[model samples]
Target chain A: MPSEAQAAPDILSVELARIAQDIDSSFDLLLPVPDDPRRPLVEAMRYAAIGGGKRLRPLLLVATAEMHAVDRDTALRVACAIEAIHVYSLIHDDLPCMDDDDMRHGKPTVHRKFDEATAVLAGDALHAFAFEILSDPMTGGGDPFVRAELIYTLAMASGANGMAGGQMMDMMAESSRFDLPTVTRLQQLKTGALLGAAVEMGAILGRVVPEGRTHLRGFARDVGLAFQIADDLLDAEGDEVAAGKALRKDEAAGKETFLSLLGPQRARAQAEMLVEQAISHLASCGAEADILRALARYVVERDR
Target chain B: MPSEAQAAPDILSVELARIAQDIDSSFDLLLPVPDDPRRPLVEAMRYAAIGGGKRLRPLLLVATAEMHAVDRDTALRVACAIEAIHVYSLIHDDLPCMDDDDMRHGKPTVHRKFDEATAVLAGDALHAFAFEILSDPMTGGGDPFVRAELIYTLAMASGANGMAGGQMMDMMAESSRFDLPTVTRLQQLKTGALLGAAVEMGAILGRVVPEGRTHLRGFARDVGLAFQIADDLLDAEGDEVAAGKALRKDEAAGKETFLSLLGPQRARAQAEMLVEQAISHLASCGAEADILRALARYVVERDR
Candidate 1:
């Protein structure tokens, strides 16, 4: 293991790059080219899932699972499932009826490249495949109960009360004025739930006790908030080219986000505080949590 | 149990009505009124799932499970899970970006009653919840292995290889000319897969051996074809008011269907023959499969 005194950013960048590469390969193996006429659906799914994003969510899952000594392959499978959910959300969110964005990850959106109907079906299929991966004994190392629990947790995180609900809230916020607390709740549901789930899933795979899981959950909660605040800052002031999509979109749409509500200076201060709090939650884990600590800081510091 | 000599039509109607009522109650109990601002998601989900068309898919699952002496409650939960998936597909299928329908089951589609965004989110949440229910030991009964198996099966049935794949194929069909074999393949993937899964799920619940399950598979396959042919007949010749949606839409769009290719007389005869074959597949199943036999007849006869 690298020394704790090592430069955090260097460690984080290397780790992130490694995780992204691993996940890309795994997704390749997981989603193969179809021989059927509906090959376009698989193609769209592969396009949306592969070659994009920071793979932050899966990295968190992997990092936490590693701390618990979970097998790399088992943790990777769960990570891929969570990543699939994230990618599906992106595909649907970019639809004409939703955000209507033309670009994502510096590439054409799935709906832009493939027709609208194909995009919808691809997203839907990806969503279903996530559960398929989690419940299959091969993915979770022959533990039916573990697989079942993972399925339940993932479904809870992705269902009406979770990510989808958050998306609905985000849409509603476009027309309605939301205060800080409401926006915070929205962020928690939309983004935090899945982030928290990543940590909780790690703990589940690790077979951590309830008390241990609570600390990880707390860590994830702060990290999720910090991540969103950073995102808001990016949307408000970050370069569109660097972000790989339109920037200042929330402001353009007159939407209320943490940045709009808190302003730039205050939002920056708040994100820093959240990152510190997030790191504090992992205090009990000692050096094993160095990756998570680095990630908490990276969430607010990254350009993208 | 009813004797084989009983009028098939009466038996089917009664059985269908009973299953519909049971499913409606189960869905009501399953999907409670939410206490959040995102209550609208749940409301849309309930609206789409509760008051709907014939619960044919769930009925098939239940009927097959009953024939194998599976517990009523366990089978009902799986039936509800499948029904949730069916409802979700309908909601997404009727989206403005997809079918753009204004009405379904004599009521406004989810997008019409709620907003387009809510309809999408609701459908997505319903999709997630299907796996949630199947993977929960309490719902699929106390066996973790059973729950995992159910989740795996349901995911396969719903994902790219199944319903979503079929939807993509159907969309492609609108822009391309499909011969009879191609249309049959499309119908098989688009509709037959899930219908077949309903029977397969029941077999899984019954713990039927692979050889025994093959017979049921054959039964579901024929019934699925017969059901689609009846749908085509209804779309071509049935009253719009009776069908609760547009009629002759395939013809108006120049879409190839069983009726369009085979003609009304040939399509009707074909449906009748398929239904007979469907019932004949269950001949070894004895009096326990009377409900299924009635359902095969009902597939070609139902007006709506």
Candidate 2:
């Protein structure tokens, strides 16, 4: 494991921290608990939202935006919006009828911590809150059209074709063998869509013209594949101490994985290839691409 | 039932049918099945969306907009949006983990018709489609800022404190006796919020001033309450064939209802009184209010 000092430069620990602080500050206002009958439900929502996680989605947005030299503060609202959407998905995914997982991020899942009923509301609230924040034109000096576009994209990313679709495929694919193409499509929708949306939102916010948008999309696509493969590797090879949860649960459950399909060494090599391609997409942007490159490397290199 | 000839001068069946037709036409373009592997899932989504119902939410929106002299065509997009939100809630509520109902609008529930996983995705797709349609400013021809407000209100109404909150409460209250006050609150959040939002959207589109907004809100609040009470009465007294599904299921489940709390006769009396109050709010709007008045009557008068 990288020491604290080494981790600082090698990965996004510092950047992720700054982004978390920024997100917490904004949600602090929008999610204030009212003393109404639904107060407990709202409190449970706050608890689920404030739970510690990697803040990967938000960091991707910020980091990608930084690559275009866009104002990091300006992207803060979108970052928070993305995080809210992610948290909402997690809450719903943990419901009894879905993944049925009892623990997440080292704490009881939302439904386990609160009643399943409250967890449902908490997830719904966060889902609504994401759009509510995104649609507020005043906060981000947001263009109404742009805000609307952002909301539309975010909703789609979190909805059927993105996270939800990925989830359905994942559920259906359980105990079944999936070819590499099928697995790629599944991971692309399940995990890559939102990550791609993060990069797209950043580029959109930067007002990067048509060509830049294409480049960013390409970069995000490669990095997203790399990111998921690394996850598969970590789950196969790492321990719970480093990964923070059960590591080999996916394999035990017989879920398809990159390593299972390609072998560990091959999967690791493929991930490196993806990272190189991702970095190549940003070469035109010069020094602005530094953090994105670091992020791509960090994706494969991190223990978690 | 009132035949076309028996309809009141203010309540033209042709006009209502036209409005419903237009709303259905608008939704047609919003849920097209893409050629992705998720196409089957999207087809199921389209099925859930296209099935016939009263289209109450859209009717309320169009009628209220008519009252404000807003063009019915201009109101079509928002009306479709409200229906999307309403339908999404229904799909999710019917999931195995939630209410677990097997039938909706006389057809098999989404999970039974498609699969549980597909149903979940169809619901998620429809939910996102609502916001997408609403946020597209080109359709509404208004300042995007105004459209943003409409999107915000819709999200909140369908979200945690509104429809989703009520759903969660309904789930928790299963087989339990909730007092009149609690039931009233649930009705407001679940049914009333969307109805109120319909009226509010019309007012926003028509650019109602502050005083007019207040009047319209009061009008919607009373009408929304009346609508739910009438729903309870229908479940209590309407014919199963006429209602298009099993009747008194809510009563059978011991779900809270106005009739349960106040008895059938009293509930009918309460619904009628609310209709009167609803009309009184539109007292000054004259001819513009006629369609709305007819709709209010329809709420209490719907046989099914």
Candidate 3:
């Protein structure tokens, strides 16, 4: 197994596919539709949660957890929690009142497939489910302290101080002129926060102290910035069929993005530089962290 | 204080007023607006959370926590989390895509006051803040186990299998005819779950074992049902000026409610019976629980 992992040019893809399937199965068991009206809500959650996305957050979590040899199932549960929050945010962001995108994950967005009300409730339900998973009673023999930390970290990453706050800034970016520093801070909270949380949660699950996670934090920060830049590049130039959603909306909305601010070539160069810096943060990490290093490279390289 | 409590004919009123102020103060501190574009998101959260509602859930939580002699501040923090969830749900439920409410707390709903996106984000931020509070580092010097339990209970109560699920059932009631059993189940989930969670969280705080909480569970269940029935009654007959929001919409939407299912006379009698039964479940407790007993009575009696 070690030889194959070392020999594979893209171990990250292998792990990503595996984590995606595992996360989906975990959600399937977590969300069984009742034979009642509430079934539709569960269905909406399942529709948005299962069989979608790059599962990048979950893969990051799982990969980082491996650094400490944490239990696989426990790591998977936490991974699912991270991805659930990510999906929930996407569903809400895609709402007509927000980004108003009609498609996601190569399919109709939850509101488009169901209704706007269902989409709202489904997203809300998924948000609740993230906490529920983190604090599940059968929490894989998880230390209560670690579980609490996982929850707090995820909450801080997703709350007003984090992703949601970034979104508020994103909303304002359209009406207000923003310089590079403002955009940088906005992306840090918006996209970077949850990405940071994924690594932080994995570290917490592995019982790594805050002090011990310094390098991992650096890795996450750089990767998060790189990911956002790649996203802008995709929006500006990537194929819509592969991207699976509307593109150039930020340009149309006149929102300032790295691509618009730096131009395509400079933005791409910056993203590549960030990816290299992210990998360097893991230099002290052993070969076990190769997947995370690959993930950093993948952040700016993936089509979507 | 004991003498005043005994002499007061409406101690529930006193406690309600006290909790409202305390909860607002807690929210005020928990949500300080940052000097950034996200300030509006925090402002929206503060607007919805700071000075609205009866604060009944917080009161119920504090009263139940008092039974176990839990730390007062700790109980208050948990109470704020509960109220935060309640307020977040109300904001989302009042959205133009959902209930399309225009007024709340005798003022414009979050959507009307700010905008749909801000309201959505404020609600999402509050939702994250609830778990953030529960798993807070200071956390009242709380037992990590208890904190985990608190998070688990609240998440379960608010998620798809709980309040959100119940909301789905409610939405279906507008389009499909629901019988008494279906309506009962819906109310149990919709309004009952969070109320039950409030009591359960207080009990968890006091280290009350699940088995030992049977009576409290029973009390919460009865109070939740009676509260919904009373709400239905209010919709049919109470003053909108006092209620602070739209009413009779259930009737307008042709939704099935306890009042619609049982008629006004029968529903009033049923609600009263539930309140009595709710109080009866508290009979085993000492004078410390008198506040809870009064809360049962208040559930059906409150005009708003």
Candidate 4:
């Protein structure tokens, strides 16, 4: 709860590590490996969900919720729900038929660790687990309307018009010629929607309806674009070991990305500009908005 | 609706067709293909969802809803929601990583007709659409608690402990020696869970609490068992063309099924017994429950 301005440079890293751990624990609580034939599926889900990644999405939700005094426990539950969706997408995207990935977060992907069928089922179970967390009376907050709203919001963000939609566009990227605007549209749907949903969900838990979410939306939008530009840069120039996965996949797939279109210099400049714009969107707020501002800075500044 | 007792032997078929049409319409309404690059993904979802299959799950939900006097349009929404889950499961289960089936309901499976990545994204999108239908205020019934409850029920039935869990067990069937009890438990989670959710969702719309669902639960349990047993029988002896998919794969995989364990005679007898028991569970109700009774009989009698 220290003022972010006075905090160390790793304010974002400290918060990221803490939220990732909390979300991991929440996933553990949600995933009870049964003493039956289904144990492997649950284990795969647990493996994919826990002990990995930057946890940026959950951090976004948690940080926004904290700004409005939402209970930490409640915030964590919503955070985990969003993270579950994120994990499921990773597992599916890494499948042999999709990205054919072998490593994630310095470890074998789920399909490589387990079999392909097990990986598919595990991804599916985690997807359902996300909704289970949002709709459950316990951990999902006391308000029925809020719970339903959360379910609806996350569903919209994850459905045909959201994350899955973006993934579809990405899948098509390999075979088609894409320019800057098309790439931007694809990223907006693929990565941007979920990030925006994370921030919007936090505001929702604080009872801030859609009309009052203008500034938060602007903050989420700029940060989301910056995050994607940074990712493209990482793919282009960052070390695979540092990124904890295969890099330069965009070039290999012949997919045009922000870095490929704008070049490294322009892309980095665009990302930094976005970070500044995102922070400016919170100009009216106090130190409570510092965490969000720091996250905007971290989006472009982080190496991986 | 005619009294099931006085109707012809095709009573079940008539109602099944009607409900299938209604559910297809609902899916059409919910899925709006975009003009953007995401169109292929949505098109795949539509092709998988709109045509094909028995639509037995939707029939079960609609029949149960009608028995409780729920609105037909509202009932169809829930029907489509449950059907969406069933269809998504079929799409994923037919993937090369899973069953690797080539055909479903006389048409190429989603993964066969569409590219593998699009199939994966379509199935994922349809999965999200189920919760979207259940959580939306317009089609999700009036009460917020009811909406949340519906989502929780479906989520539980679809998660690791339910359909996906059962799928994990099935994946293991190729390697493990499963006894009759193990197979029963697996089927209960895989197919029984969703069937129970369908009936339970209907009762939920009628404001029937969990404690009041004892008899409905019994009805669903017996029908679900009969349904799976009939499925095993069909896989063992029915025509491949009529079944619209490969047959005898259970035996090919050396997996233990009810038909494999009991032989054709005992398996057929068992399904009939379950059908009668399932019908008996509705004995306390009047003519309104007749459709359910007929559907129960259909489980044992249908050829496909």
DockQ for all models, in order? 0.80, 0.49, 0.89, 0.90
Give a tens-digit lDDT track for model 2, residues B104-173. Answer: 7788888888877577667766777787777675645667777787888888788777887777666656
Please state the i-RMS of candidate 1: 1.1
Task: Specify the poorest-scoring 10-residue window by lDDT in model 3 chain A.
Answer: A137-146
Question: How much is A153 displaced in model 4, in angstroms?
Answer: 0.8
Q: State the lDDT of candidate 3 residue by residue for B201-234, as single tens digits.
A: 8898888999999999999999999999999999
TM-score of chain A of 3: 0.96
B151-243: candidate 4 lDDT, tens digit per residue: 999999999889999999998888999999999999999999999999999888877778988989999999999999999988888999998
TM-score of chain B of each: 0.95, 0.92, 0.97, 0.96
Give the per-residue lDDT digits (tens) of candidate 1, residues A1-304. 4675464547788899999999999999999987867889999999999999999999999999999999988999999999999999999999888888999999999999998888888999999989888977797678887888888889989987789888878887888899999899899999999998999888889888767687898899999999999999888778888889877788778789999899899999999999999898887788889999999999999898
Model 2, A1-304: lDDT tens digits are 6588675554466776777777777677667876545666677777877746777788888887777677877788788888888887888777766767787777888878887657766776777778777877663456776676677678778776788778777776675688899889989988899999998888777767657588788988899999999999888888766665556767876888787899998999999999999989887787767767777888888886
Candidate 3: stretches off by over 4 Å:
A1-9, B1-9
Name the runs in model 4 displaced over 4 angstroms: A1-9, B1-9
Residue pairs with backbone overlap in model 1 = none
Local error of candidate 1 at residue B26 (angstroms): 1.8
**Ten-residue segment with the worst summed lDDT in candidate 4 chain A?**
A1-10
Clash totals for all models, in order? 0, 0, 0, 0
What fraction of the reference structure's interface contacts does model 3 contain? 0.95
Predictions: Cα RMSD each: 2.7, 3.4, 2.6, 2.5
- Please, what are the lDDT tens digits per residue for candidate 1 over residues B91-176? 99998788889989999999999988788789899998898788776965588877887788889888987889888888877778
